[model samples]
Target: MQLTTFTDYGLRMLMYLAAQPEQQCSVREVADHYGISRNHLVKVAHRLSQLGFIDSTKGRGGGIRLSGEPASMRLGDIVLKLEPNMHIVECFDKSTNCCAITAICKAKDFFRQANQAFIDVLNKYTLSDTIVSGKSFLEIFALPQPTNPDRHKQS
Candidate 1:
């Protein structure tokens, strides 16, 4: 039930952005912060932007920011969008299923139930829910926490 490295990067990027919703961050900055490959992050950023998860600006002073409120974005939906494949087993994808017991594979139903349960848990949470402490996150990341005056009002 492990997420792909690409999805991991996407999540990381989102977390970093979540911490600084008011500020735009460069893909290089995020990669450097996480000590990951900037090239890979660039691709992730581009995909996230294309998927409408993040907004990107080109040229000087240009960077990226979350497209909408973090609390409104569900984790399950985000994972589904970021992950290219959610099929846990070969039988899940009927188009290329090679399992011999496809007709009466009892285990397939169990796997499907388990997978649904996993997503159900994720669906219960939102991007904002990941940040347990905003101040601590900003302190650790050395990012300035911009004062969102209307933050209290949003709740």
Candidate 2:
């Protein structure tokens, strides 16, 4: 029941943005802070922007910021958008299912219920609810402060 790296990083990006609601951040900055691949963060950022989770701007002084209030961003909704598919087993996807026992598999129903329960739990939380103190996070990562501290409100 592990999430894909794409979803993991997407959540990280959202959390980071939510922690500093008014400041624009670059993918490179986030990648460095999390010790993750910049290339991957770039893809995640692009997809998040396309999905309307974040606003992206280009050229000088341009960066990315959360598009809406973090309190309104449902974790389950974000995961659904970031995940390619929720199918946990071959039987879950009828189009390409080749499982011999697909017709009578009790495991399929169990997995479906498990997956739904997982999402239902996630739906209980929002991006704001997941934020930790930004100061401690930055200090632990040894990342520099946002140039304009006054620009953003800390969660």
Candidate 3:
């Protein structure tokens, strides 16, 4: 199932925030780094904040940040909240199902299972999981690299 642009931008915003846990990130910063629409990102940020996924503050020195630890934010849970419809087939939604064979079509069951499987895999991962190779991820945003706590000791 293809995710909508809304979901894509939301996930990008989350990933960017997850990578910069120590500071408040602006919507413009995130949007500029990704070369996406800042206007669109604003809507996603508002929804994310409303959903308690991120915290937002306005005015001077104000921006957005993840409300929870990245490790605790499951990818599947985020997707479920951001994605309006998860139906993989036309028959999935009873109200919208117009396919004649929906009643007898075993295809619905198969598609349902496929959709669940997709979510199950995502459930196994968290926002932190997405930033596993965070050095590269950080570089993309032109943000300062996180100083390794053990760096001084190593030297």
Candidate 4:
């Protein structure tokens, strides 16, 4: 099963915040550092703030920071919340039955098991746990920049 960009960015956003535990990171700063889209990060930050993962403050010297302890924030829980409809296959959705033999499909149960296993693996690591190493983490991921040079420039 593939995660949507929303979930992908959500995780990255959390990782960025997790990296700077002592500072209040602005959406713009995080976007600039990662070369990610600030617009998209805004949405992710807002949702994360609403979900109690991050806190936002307005005014000078104010920005966003992680609310709860990172260890307490489970990756699986964040993914589940960010990704509302995580149906791996059409049959996974109750309304859409694409398979002809879903009723008697033993494979469906196996798929369910596999999905649960996937979640279990995610649960094994929190945002802090994921980025505990440092810049090496960033290097390994090869995360995209917020602005791609190939895009049009008004200048």
User: Candidate 1 clashing pairs?
Assistant: none
lDDT of 2 by residue, 100-149 (tens): 98888788888999998998999999998887665554565675544555
Error of 1 at 85 (Å): 1.8
Candidates 1 and 4 compared: the better one by TM-score is 1
Full-model lDDT for every candidate = 0.87, 0.88, 0.88, 0.82
Each prediction's total of clashing residue pairs, residues at least 3 apart in sequence or on different chains, is 0, 0, 0, 3
Cα lDDT of model 3 by residue, 1-155, tens digit: 89887998999899999988877989999988877779989999999999999999999999999998999999999999998589878787889889998768887888888988888999999999999665678785676445556533633
Better candidate number, 1 or 2, judged by lDDT: 2
RMSD of 2: 8.4
lDDT winner between 3 and 4, please give it. 3
| Superposed Cα deviation of residue 141, candidate 1 (Å) | 3.6
Name the TM-score of candidate 2. Answer: 0.87
lDDT of 1 by residue, 17-72 (tens): 99888899899999877767799899999999999999999999999999999899
Q: What C-alpha root-mean-square deviation, in Å, does candidate 3 show against the real structure?
A: 10.1
Ranking by lDDT: 2, 3, 1, 4
Candidate 2 residue spans exceeding 4 A from truth: 143-155
Each prediction's TM-score versus the true structure: 0.87, 0.87, 0.87, 0.81
